[model samples]
Target: MAPAAAAAAQPAPPSLSLPPSQFARLQPHAYLLAHLSPPPSSNQPSIRANGRAPSQFRVTSANTGSLTHTNGSAVVRLGDTTAVCGVRAEILHTEDIASWSVSRPTPASSSPTGNKRRKLTDSTAKLSAESENKEEDGDDESQIQDFSLLVPNLSLSTGCAPGFIPGAPPSALAQSLSHQILTLLHSTRLVRAEDLRIWYQPPNLGPEELERHNENEQMDVDAPQGEVDLEKNKEIKAFWVLYIDIMIISLAGNPFDAAWAAVLAALRDTKLARAWWDVDNEMVVCSDAVSEARKLSLRGLPISSTFCVFEADAASGWRAVVIPDAEEEKELDDSTRKGIQRRWVLADPDGYEEGLSQERICVVVDKEQDGKGKTVIMKLEKNGGWAVDTKELKTLVDISAQRWEDLKQILEQC
Candidate 1:
């Protein structure tokens, strides 16, 4: 055939045309890379497919006291992901707990201190303080964890995410989220045991009552009514167990952050009424007056920020300029090959970004209200890949610090 005829007979070049949404669903990694690493000749500003910067977080909104029936409730929305948390305070009578007395500290030799039945102050509070001191220090977690005072449960509703069957049991991700929340709760020591304790202070022994008490008491005491053993008389009859329930109404990604934020806001909004053990009724009684209630004094606020690293090769950095260094190309090996790959650190990744990235990092940072108020790292978790190193971790911490400040302001409005 003629040259022109032969050329005409050749097969036509293949071309594909897909809408942006369908392309993202099919080739999420490639789609993201195209936005993040556009060709240099195009002179386009590098941005994520969602029009966000590498470290940009989704819009966040928090609202507390939304559920009037619960003691405390908060609904947090992180972009498309939404989570609601409800904190219910239930009285846990000491009689119900088998190990309640086993862990109780014995009365000290010191003189009995004055007790306040109405307020939180009493000899039992002092004993609790002393008990906390007896610890190695900086570890204020003992009874709260030992007795399981804080109960946190996270549930993902049927429509929250794909593959979450309407009537199926809790998914592994749901279980993992619950574990993470519960772990953070105990690790941070956010709740104070004193806040949960319901104490009972017996009436002081008068001149005649002291003699009668000494005669009936098994242990002989020479001390008179001036300093009766108060620790022995003042007992923790019950505790307020916080049943923190987190429901994921919707999940686009970063469920942990939304869940934790809801937990924090709900706990901050929680208010427990003054409770005491009634000797006549032999049950815990809570005051009806709202003014008598007190908000929980949580520890320093810790905000969690999660980031994922997307690594791409020179060939598919969205087909952008990825010419390897001269030296790298010359000594191309396993190590050098990995070094040539591009990495993009995306913060607050949505469900799409999450599935495309293998390496993940989550930093939990806080600024304590006490003293100079410095930023502290409560937790640093990285897994799935080694793309994130020490320097990357430090950068994540800084990002988390900023996130903490932003969240603090959002929650303050609640």
Candidate 2:
């Protein structure tokens, strides 16, 4: 939501010189300014008659790992804007162990025509059945923990935002943001893999393992069924996954920051179950020994802040105010259509400012492997291209740096 103070500070806009198509894009912005500068209400967060102060922020809260079935999950609230995240895991399996094993040859094996053929076919069929059962058992062992971490399926639903209809499809923007958040966690190896594993056997010895059982059939001939031998086999590690169903319930503004924050809090509050395999009995046993839940070690928290630059006109008059933070604005009453009328940049801007703004830029900053964080600008096109100059880009970077500093201090106190 736009700050009431910025709205009060802005003047009506002047005549537009641009073509109709250009003018159409600015309409949403006019609506945004109106919303931002709406009559100040007591319900507004940190709000005064003027709307906002330079350092004022909306009310913020964290809902850590709200989903019990999931390995991890979180929801974050910034004023009226909110986002939620959930993490799930699955065990992967493969088919194809038949081609490797060789049948044992013996005098009885090479019997006369009819009996020999029947016996050979029956033996082959039995071997195939045994192999299939073994494969299933292995998968069952692996999936136990994976399912325990997160249910086979989860959905992000309407209660997240106001006026949301149940079973409605998520918007494109919401899907994209969810995908990006999940990708980051997966790519960065954020969660520990061992904590999700239920099997004690080595990775190679499990489903993907290739070897033949001996005549006794206690286990594969080459590899013994014994616990010690299984331990020496190969290993496949398990990792965490977030199945996000992001709904832009209110879309008050600054979605990137909201999404990132929600994801972070969810991960921090996630509880992973601790399990182990009992090799001797060929059974997996989970301890009553659950480890204390721990927060994910975040490299650095990156936040994106948006500012809307509005161009006002003769009819509605020239008017511009930053969406949620309008206090830092200048009335562009006399500026030509080509010049920037009013600049509204600080934190989350309401929808109206978002529509009228010439463009929006998001800054993504993160830590390098060495643990040092750096900021990068992500330009959002209002029409189709980047409109920022080098100097303006630098200014955005500086703003992000300061924002991060403020965020770090707040977190330290937490």
Candidate 3:
């Protein structure tokens, strides 16, 4: 048999499938090698393809408190890549089946068991009393409502990514990124749901009764002016909804960094409206007379950091270029550049690096420690690459700890 014929007869190997984020990590290594091998032009020494010195970072500027009406807003820029985050607080209804409290009042019109109430009084009084109870029920039902933190509905229309189009469904990438940010927030318990519970003096009222009361109040509003049922529209007692919209305005390499930075900036400036519950009146109040806007409590800020690896030589057993400190990055020599790969770790990376990194590792850390004062929550592997040994992993943790402390100090001033 001819060699060509035999080779053609062989079955093709099965293709390997990896997550999209892994694809992003593998993207940079190939292109970065070409740029790294060539000596940087002396004329444009300051401009690296990645747009940062070996030890330097992309220019970072944060403009906070930008939205005039929003509770909080921020816009962050790293070079040409920019992210804007706005936090709008809205009161909504809570559907959580948990937290049913006994002893809470039911509307006089609502049945004791939460069913429809039958008229019991004489015919003439029945009509009068029924109308009155309907009014009362509408006034008292909303004891608590859900609060939502949403990304702008208009953002999708502005063309954030190639996959995103006006009036189109969210692509898989959009869903995944949104999930990531929400998971991170939930894992860290950054926003305490219980904290939102509006405590009332001499408290007591049942959920069923509250709804009935609200129903009655709706009937009383004058035909001309629609009435807002404060009880029915009360802000949720607990839990929060965070909708993150990451606009990939530029598919620059480090979406994680940009997304996280946007998240932090938005959170830093975020605030909520204050609400008070009056136990005596058995109702929630949200008005100028009893309510005021307040900032959300942000304790021990958390930061996510990323690093890019380049120019790897698998045959020679070269692992990666560790940009652990400033000195090493400053002393990058030809041998260092050729023999070892280069890694730029910081809050954000530009388009060049995003397109050409070998592998990327991102670590999230909190500023405060636990009983042992250890703030490191969890180390996540987003884009898969060379498996880091236990020792190297610890080094990553140590670096993250230091970075966390530094950022915490920076936030204090802000």
Top-TM-score candidate index: 1
Report the C-alpha lDDT of model 1 over 69-118, residue by residue, as the tens digit: 99999999999999999999999888888886787755553323323322
C-alpha lDDT values of all predictions: 0.83, 0.47, 0.52
Q: Write the per-residue lDDT of candidate 2 for residues 1-414, one digit (tens) a residue.
A: 469888988997886676544544555444444433333332233222125542345666666646777666766676777776665543321112132123111222123431233435677868756775665454433443333322222233466445457878755666666556554444333443344443434444343243333233233233334442443342423323334434344556566577766665655555544444445754444345446434445434554455544434434554333334444334333222123233334345544344445565556544343546555433222332355567876776676677666655543433
Off by over 4 Å in 3: 1-31, 38-48, 51-56, 93-168, 203-251, 278-283, 289-292, 311-348, 369-375, 405-414
TM-score of 2: 0.52
Clashes (N, CA, C under 3 Å) per candidate: 0, 26, 30
Instruction: For candidate 1, give the lDDT of residue 232.
Output: 62
Top candidate on lDDT is 1
Stretches of candidate 1 above 4 Å error?
A: 1-16, 108-140, 211-228, 314-341
User: Order the candidates by lDDT, highest first — what do you get?
Assistant: 1, 3, 2
RMSD of each: 6.7, 16.1, 17.6
Clashes of 3: 30
Higher-TM-score candidate of 1 and 2: 1
